[model samples]
Target: MHTKASVQSVADTARGIVLATVEIAARPEHVFRALTEPDQVVRWWGSDEAYRMTNWEMDIGVGGHWRSEGRNADGTSFRASGKLRRVDRPTALSMSWMSDWDGGQASVVHYALEGTTRTTRLTLCHEELVDRPDACRAYAEGWRLVLGWLQQYLAPQSTEAFFLLRLNPPRPNFSEDMSSEEVALMKLHFGYWATLLQAGTAIAYGPVADPGGTWGVAIVRAAEMDAAWVLTDQDPVIRSGRGFRYEIFAMPQLMRGE
Candidate 1:
């Protein structure tokens, strides 16, 4: 019925453009929590397939730091960081948005709220987009997509299926004294992961943050293991140039939601 608010082109000035404000039905406080809380953000911030969010950190006060990373189905990641410039309890919030793609140039986002008896209106104003109009448009689209996702996320329905992919096969490589070549290679690997994160496919990942771990591990959830395999199956790290080897574990039910 299109009852859900539609994203409009409210104001597009000469250089700076104002995207249409989004109106959410939840309470102002609840919407603010979804925006600032780490777990809540991840749950609603991603697309349905080939896109997901992981590793979210948010500080809800002025001058606080906020960071989040998203992963794409291709096994790449993207990271963003910013400072909380303003917060007014449940009514309003403003933050600086910076990402690796733009080399840290910051954009400002302001969130405002209005409410009626049964519905609450959330108005988001993101401004000062510089250097990347594509990125800005993508983010604007993301907001519209996630609003619907958020409604589903907050619904009472349970997750249809859940499964874990325990790390298997070739062991991680590590050296107390890493060579320059190794360091460069590792950077390349990390950079790729970051790119995927921004695109919204990565589910969960880490580099063994603990002080005594032997290897890093990442867990990804996808439409199918075949898709997941396509992401990790061929790797310069795993294949040494000959190409990927190893039979993927078969688990049709997990992928099929049966």
Candidate 2:
């Protein structure tokens, strides 16, 4: 499951700035594109349902210019313009943001993305708001909601089926006493499943400490049984020439939150 986005606000009353952070379930490139790409920006930039973005244009490079015009629910038009100071793909973007409502006042907005392969932590720092501290606070809240929408937009689609995966080995007394090669493959197996867990594909996965014999169990979400099987088939353990295999069972319903 995608976790809730985290929003942090650090107010420097001495300098007048606000910093916010949020984690997204998508990769850095995807997150960066969503922030820079005009089509994607319109989908989540504003919070109000009646707020309509009439125009969004971005040059998206160092020294480039960008502008967006939108109308509020009450039909009040607003325009924002910015000049890109830095545009490092998939990592950071720095720009100067100005709004017509602010009487041509401007602030520096910096977005930094950092995380692993499947997850991205976005930190947005708005600084140089020497005159508009209230705007700084309002933008902090606005970004919190905008990033929440981005997370939902990037979440995986609902699965058609959930499957229980049972991993079987050739031997019954398998443990740390296995061959060095086998142990290495097992580590890879764990990492593989960990990735699946991070991607929100596997609901739960771990080794079962059954007294009879230990095995692996995983609950996977997929569109079809074959898709679920494909994940197991590609497991490092199964591909290591070890006699390991999997059986899958369909689960029609899973109850949660009683």
Candidate 3:
């Protein structure tokens, strides 16, 4: 299950860059259709609690124009439009994005897809908002939620399994006193798992208080153990080049009750 992730992309709020990535159990061609095709875009573009994209217009080409208009949950109206900057069917698309809710200015939105018929990795990058940090932060959550909508629309039959992640720090008292760099890395690690938790990739994760020593533990869901390894490998602690390690185990049987 430890095959590499489709894309190695993360969001940088300071840079006004937001990234939302997901691996769908479908071909890129099919996902691309759902993304660019006008008829299908209306099917999965928004949320029921918020605003649903009720109208869509698309000119499918580089330098083409696309627009979407919808009403907010409170019945207020909103609209967004963009000019296509690049188009690579089933692979990528880039455009100049501007929406009423997005600072009413031109930013950039790029979508990259990589995969086969079994599973496809999709990544969305919303960039060029250096002047609007709030928008950047909001888009971080918005894009992830939007991706969740797209995944549900695809109706995938993922090979999901429960994984137990035993996180080991360098020393016994590492948690009590971490270095400055370690603290910063912990922030990134928290954000990483927080994103996953919101996206439904993680069930629960936090520091563990052990009698002998304190460590960390994360229970996540992935297609397989290799994929679980991929998830752990991306953690800030594991990638910090420090001596942080994770022992992964599979939960063969997970019983849930009310």
Candidate 4:
């Protein structure tokens, strides 16, 4: 099972844009496919439980057009159409979006994806809403919900158990005086864990800022203790001969809620 997806929203009133970001447990190519492929879009585009996509068509290219039609639970129908402005496969896409609900009001939507082969960070920007602040907010929420559905749809199925990973370093004092090479390695270390977090292999990870010493912690999902060991042993810091080690504990009963 995967952890609850995290959605970050930023509304720039001056620019008339709503920005949303979420990390998905899949690669950029997979996420791009889900965004542009008609079948995948139908699966995760709507928020209402009873909402179902009735139609999906798209010509995926620079000047391609796309449209979708769906009905709400109450039998009310809605439609959306858009022209592809730009399409950079597996990385970015921009389109002009128009819907029937807003009296033909249109906006530009951009999706940007970045990450490694096992995880992706997706950023969505809905702009050109100069006179449609309400719609901007609504789209922000709607995108968040849709992304949640996407995450759930793409989450890796696992019958594995969970483990608590405690990271112990040689020393916990990280100050500005640290060597630049070590600092760079630490950044790589953080990046490594971030990929795991987005991949659902790690449920959560962070450094505990204790006054005595700062230690890292993570909750990992794995089939067994050896799998957990493999993950921790691959940490860049540990590989750098920095004397960082991990202690793994089996979590028999874990409770998580969103």
Candidate 5:
């Protein structure tokens, strides 16, 4: 995971041009789909509390049209439309972008993808902002944030996980064998998961009954693996000094309504 590339490099070249580059651990075809596919665009193009991209519509061909709709943190709406000038699948794309906020000025945006079987190098060039130096600086920062979101969206780790819990002794009738203090601790554990479940962060959690022993499992949603660890660390079973531990497994594609 440490070897995967993500952070972007930005540069101000000519008077009107801002160039940025980022490496993604995905095939060119996969990255290209995220670039052109409407559903994928809405997922990776922005963040929930920042610039949220709620809608995307595009026609995939040279001379076709594209549009995006989103909102800022302040509840203000924004929109951008473009006509595709070039479309090279798995390689490059270019378009003319006209946004409502930019005095309706059309800017040329180009993306060049260089990739091997496992990774891709994506370069973006936004031109025609030479006269709008303020816009040029803003774009440099904006593109940096955009590309960072893309990289995180494409990361291989699952945002949801299963936490398997067990007692150190592994007894079949442990529930019946538990002391009064242990029962209180178990209640705390149940309450903790209940809170998360009501908050929609915890999906489901319960005990697994085996003939020889009983173990517990919890399914949860977390934005990152480290975040998942934070939840598990806070589990009452873990913090109560009861010799309880949880083994976590990532569920990259979780089935809903199961």
Candidate 6:
């Protein structure tokens, strides 16, 4: 966990046209969901007084349109529109950014994600603003603040279970237990599941450090319900692994990170 002093240091660096990359403890899909979904976007997209989204419309495809309007606490409104230049699922996004306010500069923003065991590296770049340096700098600082909101907003509050699996290649005479190569294949699967957290399918996941393997948890708001079942169903570990068992026993709210 990052300390308050570290957060203050980050705020201190908000000067001039700076570029920053943030490593978030979330999956690519989860981040993507936050970016493309209106309800999720409302949770973490603006600065000051928690701007309410008045209108949001997006057609997520090449040459599609993305538009939104935000109402500030004092009833001031800001609007923006752009063309979707590119959309790569769970990986990359490119869009032209324009606003209805004065002194606004036209720019293009790009988002790229790379995954780690329990985190995702988000690379965001705003370019083509050589003529409007202030806008660029302001945006740089704005992004820094916005990312903090994204990280805290998405932090899950439930415990998750991870099941590791090994896949054996097709062989007519092979036994149920896997071979040495099959064990290595399981490692690859674990790595892949770790990557899935970047896409937000992970509530919270990491590896078991003693043996250098991946094991992480996802938080579900409720237990013994459909939401939890749906989460386990999409998890690669539980879906593909036919051997492990899933049991739901309740934990107290205080202990569950509530």
Indicate which candidate wins on lDDT.
3
lDDT of 1 by residue, 1-258 (tens): 225555443444444545646555445655666677775677567874756888789877899999988887777888988999999987888888888756777788787777653345767777887555775776666666666565544321222212233332233335355568656655665566566567756545546544443344545445433344445543444444322133223232434333
Extract clashing residue pairs from model 4: none
The positional error of residue 41 in candidate 4, measured at the CA in angstroms, is 1.6
- Tens digit per residue, CA lDDT, model 5, 1-258: 244565564545457888889987666766787788776688678876678988999898999999999999888999999999999997999999899878779899999999986677899999988678777777888888988887766554543444333333235577669989888888998999899999988888877776777777887776544455567768888787667755545565676673
| Model 4 global lDDT (CA atoms, 0 to 1) | 0.79
Candidate 2 residue-wise lDDT, 12-63, digit = tens: 5457687778777667866887788776677656656646666788997799
TM-score for each model: 0.54, 0.58, 0.57, 0.59, 0.61, 0.56
True-structure lDDT of candidate 5 = 0.76
List the global CA lDDT of all models: 0.59, 0.77, 0.80, 0.79, 0.76, 0.57
Model 1 TM-score is: 0.54
Best by TM-score: 5
Candidate 3 residue runs with Cα over 4 Å from true position: 1-11, 156-258
lDDT of 5 at 3: 47
RMSD (Cα, Å) of candidate 4? 16.1
Off by over 4 Å in 1: 1-3, 9-13, 130-132, 154-258
lDDT of 3 by residue, 1-258 (tens): 223333333568788899889877656766777787676678778887977989888798999999998888899989999999999997999999899976588899999999975577898999998867778888777787777767755542346778788888899999889989899999999999999999999989999999888989889987755467668768988888799877666676677776
Count of clashing pairs, candidate 4: 0
**How far does residue 104 in candidate 2 sit from its true spot (Å)?**
1.6
